[model samples]
Target: MCVEKTPWEQVIDFHGHTCPEIALGYRVAQIAMRELGIKPTPSAELKVTAQTHSCALDAFQVLNHATYGRGALIVEEQGQHNYMFEYTGTTVRVFITINPEILDHLVIPKDLSSRREVQNATLEAIQFLLSSEESMFCSIQKE
Candidate 1:
């Protein structure tokens, strides 16, 4: 029997491997969906603007269907983990800014030379991003 993949599994497959940035993106995408209400109409469009570039963008592509190729996704480098999601059918746009404190906490120590240690650190960070309370890791505003 063919089984369906969970959104997280699909995102990991699209992004190649699991990492903190992808987890961050996954959370951002999920929040955007909640704020905007899934695809409201058949013709509604989703436009995404990312404040900084990272593997997280891939999550938007996979989960939100906001792809760069179709010009639905854009990056304005402000060196921030901020994201904006605009749905054509909605009057309000959602803006999410990841908490800087959380980002700081997730940083891996540079001195760890062991590959297993690096992987463990990365996984721990990913788990935090995936499970933390929305308010704990980011702030959401609709405008």
Candidate 2:
């Protein structure tokens, strides 16, 4: 019997693995594109400039079907997980952040880079982030 893969599962497959950045990217991209009123594209309707070069960038492309090859995804490394979305030159900055304090609060281990438990951590973090009233974890700044 074959089971279906979730969107995040598909993202992990295309992305080679899963991590906190990837989870953060999935949420950030979803919110950013929704905020900008941009839909999934086979071509360039939305251009994403990322502040960091990580698996996070791949999530945007995988989830929204945006990519640099088609001129849809443009990555500008700033050594951070900040993202800027542009459509017709109108830009919105969406940054994914987790309060360092929250780590202890959530009890997420420091060495969560292991693929075995990383995916669990990713999902747990994502769930808490979206479900919690706390909005400090993710920020959407308009510029």
Candidate 3:
């Protein structure tokens, strides 16, 4: 019985591992979809502009079908967790900026190099990202 993977599982597999940034990307992608009231399709695709190059972008690639090869994803690397999403053939655009304070709380234990400890910390951070309220983690602007 071959079963298909969930969207989240696909994202993790593509990203090579589970991490907080991927979780953040997942949440941001969901918010973008909700705010814009649309999903990316072959004809109506999404153009995503990412402020930082991180694991989170993988989520957009999986969920929004926005890929760099197709010119649907752009990364400017501004060192912040900001994302702008626009659907093709539409005037609506959504901007999401992640709150720094929320990121501050997700600090990984740098002193502990133990693989188990690091994995645990990353899992905890991913959990926090997944559970946080949209308003608490990011500010959304529509244009």
Q: What lDDT does each candidate get?
A: 0.90, 0.66, 0.87
CA RMSD (A), model 2: 4.7
lDDT per residue for candidate 2 within 14-70, as digits (tens), equals: 888655556667777777767777444434366677766776778888876778688
Model 1 spans with C-alpha error above 4 angstroms: none
What tens digits encode model 1's per-residue C-alpha lDDT throughout 25-134?
A: 99899989999886778998899999999999999999999999989999999999999999876777899999987887457788989999999999889888888887
Better of 2 and 3 by lDDT: 3
Give one digit per residue, the lDDT tens place, for model 3 in 108-134: 868977999998888888888989887
TM-score of every candidate: 0.94, 0.66, 0.91
Better of 1 and 3 by lDDT: 1
For model 3, what is the error of residue 91's alpha carbon versus the real structure, in angstroms, after optimal superposition? 1.1
Query: In candidate 3, where is summed lDDT lowest over 10 consecutive residues?
Result: 33-42
Error of 1 at 46 (Å): 0.8
TM-score of 3: 0.91
Give candidate 3 regions above 4 Å deviation.
39-42, 105-107
